[model samples]
Target: MMQLEQFYCRNYRIGPSESDFRSMYRPSAMLEHMQLAADGDLNAMGISTSEMLEQGLGWMLLATDLSILHPARLDEEVSLFTWSKGSKGVLWLRDFILTNHEGDRIAEARTSWALIDLQKRKPLRPSAMPVEVKAYPEHSLGDIPEKIILPEGRQTRETDRFTARYSSTDSNGHMNNARYADLCCDNLTPVELAAGIRRLQISYYREVHMFEQVIIERTDAADGIIWFRGMAADERGTVFEAKLQLNGAA
Candidate 1:
């Protein structure tokens, strides 16, 4: 059997469907692409999430840090590379680098994942995988997203509310991780949206099932970073939290 390459690359062109109202590629769509690339690479390496599910295991996103350096053009195909960066304790690491035709960087990301026993809802070590995934730590995309703690006493207001409808839920019977990027952007006020997304940092806390109403709460720091915390009307805990850095918010 031919051994698969540790690094994987895929090319994608932005189109009307991938771009938002701003005519720029949507972050949510970009994340979904990343997911597809990751899964494809994993399948080549001898394991796929679908295969894991049969064993009562699944992958869950813990945190992700995506930074956009330059937005890709709608007419141009961009090259994206992804590789596993090994694991840390129970958390598996993955990184991505996206570049345009000229080899100029478009975006990069560092993501953390955890394997879980689907039936028991318990985290498992990467060693439990039926096929071990190789790591290419040399391709790390920088630091993984850190846990975000919303400031105490900072004012946070409800920005938007919506039901986790059928269209948003995946086979897991809950919202997919990538969809939250659009949700976060949709809740942004015009001022915040106009600032433009330069970096997106997210920490997934829990799942939002179909029919559950999610109330998006937002706050901004003096430095221009907009923070969001999604809470479900029926759940006591936060569904997710995210930090958005605008083009010049640094």
Candidate 2:
């Protein structure tokens, strides 16, 4: 087991803007914080984004499984630790742990990433990168699924349709991975949003570019889990899919 001390960690203070109506940190904001910590870990390992992009290559997220034990609130300070769990073929795995100022666990996540050729938009073999992989300790949240499967035959409906805008893009020039969480939540009813998300798992199938319209579909709630799927409106295929497990209002 990799120990916490072996990971690269960063501290963050929850600002008012990062919280929701209940003052709890928003799911999107938490995802962003995890991303920042991952970036920090990559930088520490001499695997900066600029360095990769210089080679006409970049990292793309394939999936993420996040479990929120206790969402942080405004004015609360938390520490986020992230480390690589090594690579397997073209895919690399990483894990994150977020702890409160009192050292209590708050959240944990496991993420899978793949290297891609920026020009061709094709995945590259892990060997294409010069960086070395090191296994780290896994968080207490347990192992995450390599893929999230949506239950079939559930009552489904078209929730919303919208076009991706420049503002929704990230440095990679595609829809930001964190924004997917926001989009998923947007499909939820007010009551569902108020229930809040206790756990979230997302799988990215294809990238969505600016000006591309997307159709959002969601399955009726089943045992507190709501499943969502986003597809390109033009028949470009599936963009991403997600499952959210809800918790009662805070």
Over the stretch 1-250, how does candidate 2's per-residue lDDT look in tens digits?
A: 5457768899979999888888989888888888888888878877787887888988899999998998789999999988877777788788888899887889989898988999999988978876865566344345544587666676668889978898889888888888899898888888887887899999999988899988999998878888898889999888988888999522
* Structural similarity to truth (TM-score) of each candidate: 0.93, 0.93
lDDT of each: 0.83, 0.84
Q: Top lDDT: which candidate number?
A: 2
Candidate 2 Cα outliers beyond 4 Å, as residue runs: 137-141, 248-250
Least well predicted 10-residue stretch by lDDT in candidate 1: 1-10
**TM-score for candidate 2, residues paired by index:** 0.93
